[model samples]
Target: MLPRPVVPAAATTGALLLLAACAPTVPVTAAPYATDPVCAAVVLATPDSLGDGLDRVATDAQATTAWGEPRDAVVLRCGVEPLGPTTERCESVTTPNGPTIDWVIVEDDGDWTFTTYGREPAVQLLVPGAVAESRSTSFVDALGPAVARTEQLRQCL
Candidate 1:
């Protein structure tokens, strides 16, 4: 048998330790703020409790957040350009008297896409079909109150 190249014991130990320390850390890309100040405050006031099954992913933006690590299932983007005078249906969500926020919801292939209406510099959330089934209200409800601090005055009627 050909003699195996002997790797030093010390070298093997160092390799193992290096591999252990090199675990991947996924960093979420932050969404642009559209240069709005209100969006910044909402991010600061965001609630820490997002409920079970959803994890707050590490993000680059103060106003952007993802619900999964490495891969995002639910993404929240604040300060998107607001839609003006659209025929799309709007639903008013009742909050704990913070600020009334209306949502323009679109569902396709089980995926739920939500954008804040009756507000300037809208906030958008993309909820995957699978995630929406398990955690429909929990994620949106928690973020609503926080984002409501922006104080949208327009009504969705």
Candidate 2:
């Protein structure tokens, strides 16, 4: 009688497929704004806190060119109507690849105070309204914090 052939466990079909399906999936996410608490600190900034020439953050022609032609970076403003003027807290990226700066700007105010997180103690805060808004790294780390803070302040007013 011919010897019976044996099938090895490693040769089993669909084992690889099963393993692939079981592997964890990690969604790709954008990088946070500098990972510094100072950059993330937008709520503390007030109109009174800012000095002169803070409004035109990236407007200088020379600066603009270096920052990729000055694209209209998204600005998250809370505490008041977006277009209408008020003491709304605002945060935006100065340039596409530049640092993310937090600003507390009020209408008719000459001083536009801004803050940027630097390397040091890293403190991460979840924006108050993060769940309601579309989740983005920038929003979660920077925009959300500022907007959430402004919203909180607006509720008081």
Instruction: List, in order, the clash count of every candidate structure.
Output: 0, 2
Query: What lDDT, from 0 to 1, does candidate 1 have?
Result: 0.70
Global lDDT of each candidate: 0.70, 0.29
Task: Write one digit per residue (lDDT tens) for candidate 1, span 27-80.
Answer: 534445545888777766666546675666545555676665335457777877
On a 0 to 1 TM-score scale, where does candidate 2 land against the true structure? 0.19
TM-scores for every predicted model = 0.71, 0.19
Q: Candidate 2 regions off by >4 Å?
A: 1-69, 82-140, 151-157
- Which candidate wins on lDDT? 1
Candidate 1 lDDT at 132 equals 73
